[model samples]
Target: MPRRHVKLHARPPQEVQGEAVDVLVRRGLDDLRRELDVPPSFPPDVLAEAADVVRRGPSGSRVDATDVPFVTIDPEGSKDLDQAVHIGRLGDGFRVQYAIADVAAWVQAGGAIDDEARRRVETLYAPDGRTPLHPPSLSEGAASLLPDQVAPALLWTIDLDAAGAPVQVGVHRASVRSRSQLTYTGAQAAIDDGSAGETLQLLREVGLLRQAAERARGGITLPTPEQVVEQGADGVWTLGSRATLPVEEWNAQISLLTGMCAARLMLDGKVGILRTLPDADPRDVQRLRLSAHALGVPWPDGATPGDVIRDLDAANPRHAALLTDATSLLRGAAYVAFDGELPAFTMHAAIAAPYAHTTAPLRRLVDRFVGETCLALSAGTPVPDWVRDALPELPGLMSAGDKHAAELERGCLDLVEAALLTGREGQVFEGAIVDVRADRDEGVVQLRDPAVRGRIEGAGLPLGEDVRVRVVEASVPQRTVRFALADDQADSASA
Candidate 1:
């Protein structure tokens, strides 16, 4: 397994001083698309076929489960709803029914929609918009698990014992109607104000149980604050960091639970695609310990990396920097597809579990096939020929999409930061030294006020210490920002 370096997004700057950032980000995104050869739109025939599929509606055999009060929880304005969940207490245990969009039901094998989806692999997101893998008519319309609308879904009914570990897992195709569409904020408020209905409350309970189980299994959870681009009242784009809500984690646990169950199914059934990550290198862990010491974060004696990381505060700049640098430990994530023999490696290091992605078929390409595999295995039927043939090709296709997604995210952030600091070159700003190069000639500094991260050319700068820096360059076209230590700060460091 190869190592994968995952970069964390910084919080938005306090104030953005310049023109609206939307135009610049839009242009940069277009350039990135061209450079990556990302498909601009679905082929016209694919769209027409999607429309025809929508009219034809769900076909073949499926269990009717519209009575289940499943609900969707996503970002405030998300249209491409993927998974809807229903939870209930069963005696001393729990039952979770997760419904994933039945994309395979609508997309025929080797058809126009299927061909285009195979090419795109996954949805590519930008600040201004997104390039979807499937036509919106299916991804967001007929196939989406919107409220009160019956839609085709791959349903997973998982029975968990009191310890939150799955005791039984069942998967099948079904017609499901979401009772309502809820957002993270709304769900959190409901949980806080005692307005949360039975399902939401049960979801919280099961989510926490699963979270505890994850930790007990030595899983690593990094509560890194997200840098988000938002529009102000005047329509100017600004970057800011948003803290992850408890509800978000709780909701995510449901997905993780389903994924783990799916992985076990595949391992037992002898064929499927899995999201796998190798364990962190011992050298990386030692380096992280040294970093924690320098950053004044406590890594108590005999503590595992996961234990120490689970307690860090995301709001603290030093801790955030440590998390950013910790990306070095979480590399080599890849999709492994198998037919008869199980892959030599099966566990995802971060999750500390054998995991398969079966919950977000609408957004991801591999999940579609994983869902199909689970359904077939549960029914004691053979895996579809299309899905079996696709196993070998999915890893490469998904890898390409992963690279494009990362580039789009990081590139947009770089463009926004450069735009925000265009006229502020040569101005001194306070920042923290988040990272240092081995050569000691330069390091990565994160500005305190504007929340901009850029390279600084300075020697002997202490990691995790604050210093005054002068912005030497900011170029929007190149999406680069360079800084140098202020005169007094440089002199003091040298001394």
Candidate 2:
């Protein structure tokens, strides 16, 4: 899986340049987008339809609920807002009202915009820009959950009991206005300083309760810190990393709560799609235990992988190695659609629940269909035939989009790593072996200073141990970086 990085790799020219080497980085990313067959622009007909829809305005059937003091949270500078939330405390419980962008409201079932979105599958992100599933006129404009905009949305009111488990759930179309838009950093700062409003404070209380509940339920969330590739004020590309903020997880819980509810609704209605991952193989689990023991991380008796992972800090070298290795179990995620028959495998290994993607309809294609399906299920209305028709094709489309996104992202990151190391061939750097292949002759070495990971060549490279490695190769065009044990050269000379 390609890790999600905070990329400054948006549109080129004056913005991306940090100097001369930055030019190479920019070119490499462009090559990657082309290689992935990413569509550069929306079709003319689709653009026209999106513009027409924007002019016509949102659905008139939406109920008035703009008085709800909703707020949006996301990365800084994000414009394609999808979900807005308002949380208030109930008697010994919490009430969460989440408003999801009603993409289906603006997109007619068989229109050109719909057909184009189907062909595109989902949004694709790169360092330069995003290939949006819907044009900006809709995704970032009319259909967005921008603050104070009074947009049409599918409003979900979920009431959770004292233990953070859902006690009641209902969803309907409504006209919503977000009171404010906040970034994770901004929200966390407010809460930490004790200056947050009722919603932010309640978010902290409810989020902690939900996190505790997740741990209690053996849910797995491998929040492996992202390798951030950024450009400094000097226009120089720099590589660093940061862990997911506490607020991010809490906000994500709200989305996950809605998705779980959506999955429940579809399951009861016997017609919907799901985001599923099979349980990890027992042998892999046992192997991970051995890895943990080798890395000096103690695994308590009868502790689930999620339990151990929850306590392991990604900042620690030993813990990071284990987290890197544990990613193997998170593979095989897929989309499953059903009309009458329920799929046996519905649990998302990470979420540890029957989950669906219902919150991010702007960026993800399936969430629109899911939101529509769940709405019909909640309203006791028939599932739209168009949604039913799109279900089977969704898996392939999403899978392809996921593949392209992962490939493009990984390629871009690799290019940066290679370019950053290009002039330092043969230089020794301190790094820890975070992962080793089954053969034990090669492994992944994460550098301490630059925060880059690359293949290390050697026999029996010690996992989790700090070692010095000499860069053997850095190819910008190839998007590769390879290192060899510094001792390899010493051993040869001594012999």
Candidate 3:
């Protein structure tokens, strides 16, 4: 991956003119309030009451969690801890001990908490903070995999062979005692410094092997920049890059592996929604191929586009650029639910597998239903009526949540970037060429450092990743930052 550099100059926050951030906020709040019908309070008793109801439900099996060495890996200060994983060597493969918080264990079928959870549908993240799907008292406290706390969970042990293929999977309900709470950054640092504990080392190893396997399977590895907004002492918003460590990616890979297995089961039974995206169109592939060739990147002949992507992403900066640029081709995602048989297009282009959202039940409502169903099926228990009822509505609800969340996150980013750029209006700053449009009328120039991009002139200038440019204008009110040629106007005229 290409390294990103930053040039920082300290300055106070300025009022961004022209943009109505309040309108965006209002719209976001309205979506949460009106569309989701989010509950007003984060009460502890709600979860406790729900758990009591589930406890009384008829089931021949028992669930516990106090013995398993489950641990959570999330961002520092994250309240809604969703998952805890443990991995170890098993034969020539590895045993992945993943403990996902059992939201279904607590939230009763057709209860108030369940209704509220369904209403929220998904968690909302804003510049200020997050509106968690579950109350903090349960999500952050009781059910969370806090150190030494025994919590009810759905435990999955997946055995992956040395080649990183999952050979076997075991699912059960249990009470787990988390040894400690680990942050992704902390775990990554330990792996880097070679002083990581046994558990963390296993995590790093598993993640590495899984990543290698995915690459071998022709999965697209794109370098996409993520923006995070942090509040300052003066209540000003500042933009920062969100670093995704190898371990984080690996952790996600494990989640994908589990979801894929669950999806396979659902499909074999010929029912349930699977997260699906069609393979890239041939024209898009051709365009990508030509672009890579134009950039002097190696495009492997006689191989699939995925093969070209893998080889290029591994070769040169041009190839890396090519890989990232192809991200826009993957779109028009659909929630596929069928009973007769699985559809031909159930594959997710990114992971190269049929997958579903099944692991993050605490954070996502759809996951709760899917997770519960998976658990019941795995345990040979009858699928709950509420879960059966929930399966159909989840596709639409989750998709709507995805749209709403994306808008809020992107909107907040625009506002913050606009606010940050106000401090440097008419000031020249270095940037990279992220994208170019054939129309010339529509183009975005992304910066490499201080990393903000914008629509800019593109008549003759080549727009490729990491190509340098300069900021020409910054508007907070308009929620836009403009760029121009970095060289002197005299030099430009002479040229």
Candidate 1 stretches greater than 4 Å from native? 1-22, 438-440
Task: Give TM-scores for every candidate, taking all chains together and pairing residue i with residue i.
Answer: 0.94, 0.94, 0.85
1-495 in candidate 2: lDDT tens per residue?
Answer: 123333333322222235456788888887888888888788899888888889999754988999999999999988999999999988999999999999999999999989888888788776666789899999899999998898999999999999889999999999999999999989989989999998899888888888887888789888688877777656677777767778888899888889999999999999999999888888989999999999999999999999888777766778889999899788899999999899877788878889999999999899999999999999999998999998989989998878877887788789988888887788999888898884757889999767789998877677787778899998888999999989764375246
Residue 256: error of model 1 in Å?
A: 0.6
Candidate 3 whole-model C-alpha lDDT, 0 to 1? 0.68
Worst 10 residues of 2 by lDDT: 8-17
| Candidates' C-alpha lDDT | 0.86, 0.86, 0.68
Query: How would you encode candidate 3's per-residue C-alpha lDDT over 1-495 as one tens digit per residue?
Result: 432323333345454455343444334444444443444465566667645654564233446656656677888878677788787788887888888887776676787777777777778877666778877666677767678876777888788888778888778887777887888878878788999776678776777777777777667656543666666565544566554667777778888889988887677666667888777787888888788778876766676666666444322345445755788678778777654666777888777888888888878888877777777677667777777777778888888888877866766666556556654656766555556665764456655445565677645555454444556666544556777666663255237
lDDT tens digits by residue: candidate 1, 111-206: 999889888888887777888889999888998999999999999999999988899999998999999999998998999999999889988899
> Which segments of candidate 2 are over 4 A away from where they belong?
1-19, 438-440, 488-495
- Which of candidates 1 and 2 reaches a greater lDDT? 2
Error of 3 at 212 (Å): 2.5
What's the best-to-worst order under lDDT? 2, 1, 3
- Among all windows of 10 consecutive residues in model 1, the one with the lowest summed lDDT is 1-10
